[model samples]
Target: MQSSSKLFPVTLISAELRGDLSEDVYRLKPGNSPDASVELALTRLGRADRETTRGVPVVLIPGSFSNRRFWYSPKSIGLGPYLARAGYDVWIAEMRGHGLSPRNQRYKHNKVSDYVRYDLPAIADFIHEQNPQPVHWMGHSLGGIILAGALGGHYLQQTRVASVVLFGSQVSRIYWPLKVPPVEWGSRLLLKSFSVISGPRLKRGPEDEPIGLALESLRWHGLLGRFGDADKDWWAGLIDVQVPVMAVAAEGDHQDPAWACRKLMEQFGSPLREFLCLGKKQGFSSDFGHVEMLVSKQAQLEVWPLVEQWVRKSPEVAAQLAMQPDRDEASAVSADQA
Candidate 1:
């Protein structure tokens, strides 16, 4: 285990009210690891009236090659502000070297293991410090993978987390060729030669991802691989996780298909868990894509409300939804509407 003193003080960079929501951004620096000067940006959104923030704190983490903008854009149309306006205290965290968080000393050397072991705990501690209640966590794509890794590795305590929501996230986006020894070795070597996978250049998103992450992914999908890092077997540990979970996948999402997401959800040990697949066939207005599952206008109307239900409604609702076995957005819509 690492020293707790690796965490340094957090600095509040700016605070101002944005329309109905109050926005505050803070910066955190860890004293050690691959990068000492790596600063993480945590943006908090709540009602302008503090007294109205009665709901449990919720943390929204964006996926790879993304920032807080993925959760709440400049127009204030994203889910962060939506949750905040609904009376829940909302916090959106940027991974190191992304968004407002500047690149660290060893930014190119960063991996998901580093994020789970270091960054998440720091964010959790800071959030729990201010809001003592057990917080709800919602993550999209790679963000969800990182959250699950933290939970499975026991980096985050189950008692501190009220619930978890993973959107279009899975570790089983399998490429069988990567399982071959020659392919695995070649891929790893090629990835290590690059500093990052450039998001802007690739037109994938607005942020770049470290090559370290690519290398790590290669190892996980390789022939000798299981869904774990060098030091921790996160996938194996997920079977013991008991926190309430809601895993949501979209039918149109080829990046992380619904079946893989469902498999991940089924691996969890939680009794209160629900799996949601969003598509026209499932009664959603459209088959939501990876980004569209959380960001689009349709999601605002049909999806966000269900998330609110998952957050604010009784645990029994999730458990009952789980019991159906045939549950989808259609059942979720009726349940939330009911």
Candidate 2:
């Protein structure tokens, strides 16, 4: 991947706290303040005069070992730009240690828990404060897991999230045992070790090779496997989550199989849930794997439409559709009786 010589401004704030994978830090000086408050920056990529039609504020959270740039990449396969074009106030977050949001001076390492406790909550609070409207949340891979964990708990409960969209994420490690590991042996040991050693080495930017290499490491460790029994049961409790959820998986993705993806939606037990599995013929490469589903070029044309439509539809509209009696049920009954 070619390096970008262009310099982008980034702010460094003081460390509020520290966690296993990252440190809780405020966005102080956006351009260069050692002691500023949370800062916001905007990048205009497309036609400026196109009347911006704002919909629900949408926050795009990237997967593990990645930064917000994954979503904003010029060649991103996901719906970041498409959603922006569709008129959603889209914001991409860089969890501590990634992208522009590195830890403050005192903090050294980044942690997965930091994402749940600090990164997401901060984003949710910021969006709510700025828009005063319900925000929509979308995450892929580890990002999805972090959001799910946060939503399941008390975090972000006060915020009015319109919906939650998880791509290739399950509630517990059980769904992806290889990714975590047995509790007896200390779950997340592999991940934690890797993060401690390699997390700081990762650089920010739109380079595909580095991103691919990072994902490859996770895949090899079985980080994408299905959750275990304990995790499955823990996730089952999250079925009571009131928010609408859309779970998507790729048919050819070894990281997240169709069954596991379906299981995630089923666990939600939300009548307002939807699941999709992208087929290889749908333009998804056979090796599309796990992370590529979000960054792959084909996702925009094939996978993004489902998400776009869901985001646009109102809760009332979705409820009405759900209330409609299943037409296929009658056909199934008739066939069974026959």
Candidate 3:
């Protein structure tokens, strides 16, 4: 590991025992990236004092302007810790410039393309090397978009991925006006004046987002836009991704509505895919919001258990879903809308 540090230096910054979990923090410099200053933070949680765990490796990625704390609070009682307690190798990831991951040289220029093309692959490669099994990936909001982009862009291979669970993630959000070429061009020009989007000022989240990300989005949503990057046609490429996918959306989340989420999920070529809409109408206790769907008490009881089952079942359940008769898409959509 030390010898490989020259190529990708990984430093174990901290390790502590927190209740029933052992928390370890690592700083990885996948020095291979064009940006030499890029650093990423990864948090690993396992049963305290236990050298080996029983379940498959599970990775949790938080959304834009969020951190690992999005998955678990300070009390260590969030989904990350819950999964660790359930005997899964839990890993919480913080994207570059978020949380413990400090801003890099090109931080302002960093976009989702960079995340999918560089950061995610590095993190996945490292985790795979340590765990030696196909990993189950769970991402929220922008994090899920990053995961989807990686999959569609072929930054990650099906062999390295067991399954994907997305929470309130979609690329086709209500930005139809941006589809106009002139409007997109004007929007990009305006956004270029700023280096970052101030989360505090916007009252959006805890961290700021790069203008580069905003620019990339403008182009994607622009006229003749595709869910693709310079290197790959991600939107079209999703049809080739056969891995099982679970796209979870919230009725209360106007930011990424259930309809749009379902639209994205339906595009996947995977026969073993599902769209879960959380709301009282869906038999849930409350209409879960974007953040609340994962952090709130309602989520701990209702959502986490469902996620646990998905991770535990993985390929087996996915295979079963593929073999089952297709559920009426129109009826399912109506039910979710209701």
> TM-score of each candidate?
0.91, 0.65, 0.92
Task: Write model 1 residue lDDT over 213-292, tens digit each, in one string.
Answer: 99888888988787777778999899888788889999999999988998887778776667889998888899899999
Query: TM-score of model 2 relative to the true fold?
Result: 0.65
What lDDT is reached at residue 190 by model 2? 38
In candidate 1, list every pair of residues with a backbone clash.
none
Q: lDDT for model 2, on a 0 to 1 scale? A: 0.54
Question: After superposition, which runs of candidate 3 have C-alpha atoms over 4 Å from their true positions?
Answer: 1-7, 319-338
lDDT of 2 at 281: 51
lDDT digits (tens) for residues 1-338 of candidate 2:
22111222233343321111111223422322232332332222222333343456788787765666667653433467677666677667765545665444423333344445555665665556556678778888767876776765546673387778888875432434544545323533433444243444444223112222232334334544322221232254465676777777766666567667666666654456666666665444453457666666666565677688878874665466457666343221111000
Residue 303 lDDT in candidate 1: 93
C-alpha RMSD of each candidate structure in angstroms: 4.7, 10.5, 2.9
- Tell me the lDDT of candidate 1: 0.85
